[model samples]
Target: MNASMLSYILLSCVLLSVQAHNCQVREIIRNTKSLLNKTEESWSCRETAATPCSCLPIPEPGHELACFVEGTNHMMEHNMTTDNRLFLLNQSFQIQLDRNLCESLTSGKECKYKTKGTVKTFLEKILKTYQEIHKSRV
Candidate 1:
């Protein structure tokens, strides 16, 4: 085989790898956005004057872009796929929730009371992590 032909093959491989990486990043961003939306919806449904539940507040605009960049960087750093990161985040949130609240809700009991503070804390941690990721990228 000619040296030129070998070089062309190598270049093609590199380009393909880059494209694959870009695709993975895009998928991660999409999945993260979907998860955030779902979380916000659930929080809105649970929010009330007495037992308020809320997720991290997104800024007016450009928030999604920031989150996408942050998430992509984090996934890359951790060598994790979109689905894996989402699952880990969900598991972490669940673990951080108040045990009593979880049990009450899961055991078919009248869970009238819940600690909004705890939920807020969990959301803050997640948001802060992303913010740090974004800042580092910047």
Candidate 2:
């Protein structure tokens, strides 16, 4: 191939890689939002003790998930109710899996098989974290 043609091909490859990275980040974010939203809805409905509960997303760059709870009276409670406790336990495990997936993506690894799994995991983490905090009332 001509030198010009080769250069064009290389440039195209580089551009594609950059695009893929951005796409991956975007996908993760989208998935995280969906998961958090669903979890927040479920937790809010199930938890009777906490009023005006919510999973407030923490804004951060890249593939990271963090959340805080709002509208819970901490002084009145010290532990999570039975339903909330069980939900958190399941969600925490899911979050750990998601964290691993995010780490892979951030570390320059490609998620060829299933990116959705990672996104789902991070969302669970956000939800679980929100519930756990409300449960602890701290």
Candidate 3:
């Protein structure tokens, strides 16, 4: 094959690879959002004493999921009476997750509660990878 033809083929391959990577990242984000919605629904309780409340799987761009909860008021001050004990339990759970994320330099804004940390790092990593692969396009 001619050198020019070979170069063209290589360039096309690189562009396709970058597109695939971005698609994968977007897919993950979608799945995570679905999971968050489920968590919020399950977590919302009319009575503070309700059992079996579900904990949401924290999204990597932590702030997005929290924003999702803003409308719901973090399940606080809703039809259900708020329980201090249950509130503390929820905060602790979020804090643990945030601590783990921060350890990896994946911190972002806090979640619905101030205790929750944003996981911007995970998304940032994907973005950085995308940028590297599509440097010419940017």
Candidate lDDT values, in order: 0.39, 0.36, 0.37
Pairwise lDDT winner, candidates 1 and 3? 1
Cα lDDT tens digits, model 2, 1-138, are: 999999999998886566443333433334335544544223332223555322223323332222211111120132223334334333432343344423422332221221222223434544444344334533
TM-score of each: 0.25, 0.23, 0.22
lDDT per residue (tens digit) for residues 58-84 in model 1:
322223333323333433354333445
User: Which ranges in model 2 have alpha carbons more than 4 Å from their true place?
Assistant: 1-12, 19-23, 40-138
Steric clashes per prediction: 0, 0, 2
Clashing pairs in model 3?
Answer: 46-80, 108-118
Per-residue CA lDDT of model 3 for 5-95, tens digit only, reads 9999999888656633443334333433433333322333222356422222234344532332332234344422243433432343344
Top model number, TM-score: 1
The best candidate by lDDT is 1
Q: Candidate 2 at residue 100, lDDT?
A: 43
Ranking of predictions according to TM-score? 1, 2, 3
Model 3 backbone overlap count? 2
